[model samples]
Target: MKLYKTFTSIIAFLLLTSCSVFEKNRSEQNELAYMKNIEDVAIEVSKKQYVNLLQPGDRLIILVSAQDQDVVKVFNQNYSATEQFRESSVPRGNIISNSQPINGPTYIIDGDGFIDFPVLGKIEAAGMSLDHLKQYITSSLKRYIKEPYVQARITNYRITVLGEVRNPGQFTIADGTATVLNAIGMAGDLTIYGKRDDILIVRNVNGLISKERIDLTDAGFIDSPYYFLKQGDIIYVTPNKTQERLAKRDPNSALYISIASIVVTIIALIVRK
Candidate 1:
């Protein structure tokens, strides 16, 4: 009867400890869920704003079309030749000028943040919308190219992903607009232990740098102002507590568990005796 009592006591003690551990883990999981819910609310508030205008150091690909091939050729030749020159260091000057018609010119923004158009002289393009810049360029092209159609786009708008992602690096968006989620997907998505509730976005708007937090686990993120990422945006994902704890633990520390088991066994033996 005494032996039976001892066995029951041991079992009861273990059950209590096991329940405590289980409850602790459950509570932790619940806390994570609650935090994620709050994040969803923040993301829902972010999506109402449109993307800001372009900035300096942005690469632009502008296309111009006109009724006269000769007029269009002047613009097109510059871009075509520039592309060729960029692809290879070869001298584009030797290329036959009349071999290909010029459609539009391609020029990087100078340090002064200006692009020099053939007939428009120097026009301020940085911070201007594609439509507004196109209108200005089209008006000027009328003096040279009849009924000119102009289109402009930022070609090198890229986002950088860092910390806690499967892959972190600069990702280029072919389209002018890329969402925060899209940028994450390009970086191979967040890791399992990534803190989805604490994603950070660093944006430079009108020469001012702004930092924002986003939560990707909730549907509300679809409507965030930070939802659509602009050029030169940086995203940083933080690691959660679980990941940090695992990182700090030494895999070779099996001795600690062994010591704990031995101490528990000694105490049990004393109680039985």
Candidate 2:
């Protein structure tokens, strides 16, 4: 009976220690909005909204159309040429004809923040908005074709989500605009081990790279400039304190477990004796 009691005590102690180890690995259970007594309050959006400006290394798709396809054909020849160039770069296979229906041609902004347009030449498009660029191009085309219509959009607008999210990768923004929440949703939301109160956003605006740390626990970030994500924005959901502690834990945890088991067995043997 004494031996039986000693064995039961050893097992209980082992179970308690194992439970403590698991508690350390458990994730934080803090709610997303940690604000106390939060009520529905009408918050006015900031007047200074975020607008994506043209920047170097941006890919743009500019299409010109009018009542007559023949009249505007010259203005759109670059689109066909760009497609042909892309096709030629690919491996020898079933090559697509340049006459094939494609969305539009992509214009890559050069390092100097300029796209070498066919007829427009080197026009400054670095800081111009899409609407502003379209108006500028329309005015320039007026000299050649009457009633010229210009449509411009960024083709390669992408956002990257990293760190403790369920899915971490680069996602393309089809509509050319998306909010930070949209990015988080695309990444399958943050994991339980993610630091909801502290998030990092890296942005590049008009040749200037900026980093901003946002707190998801507060509703105030909804009105911040970082609310609206820009092209090539990177959102990193940092790991919570619990996750960080787990990461910093000893690499020889298995060895420690083996040593503990040996010690427990030795104690049991002595108790049996």
RMSD of every prediction? 9.9, 7.7
Tell me the lDDT of model 2 at 196.
78
Tens-place lDDT digits, model 2, residues 1-273: 687587768767776776786666552454443323233212333343556677788787777888888988777755644432221112122221233333455688888888877688888888887778889999999988879987666657778999998888887653356778778877878988887778899998666899998887676777678888988899999887767776798756746776876787777878777
How high is each candidate's TM-score? 0.61, 0.67
- Lowest lDDT sum, 10 consecutive residues, model 2, at 87-96
Please tell me which predicted candidate would have the highest lDDT against the true structure: 2
Question: By how many angstroms RMSD does model 1 differ from the true structure?
Answer: 9.9
Q: Show model 2 residue runs off by greater than 4 Å.
A: 1-7, 18-27, 31-48, 80-102, 111-113, 120-122, 138-149, 204-209, 250-273
Per-residue lDDT tens digits for candidate 1, residues 1-273, read: 576466557656665665774576566555454235655556654645454565677676677777676767667546654442112111133211222332335667776779876656788987776667878888878777768887665556668889888878886553356677667776777776678788899998768999999776676666677888887889999888756765788743445545655566666667667
The residue-level lDDT of candidate 2 at 144 comes to 85
Clash count for candidate 1 is 11
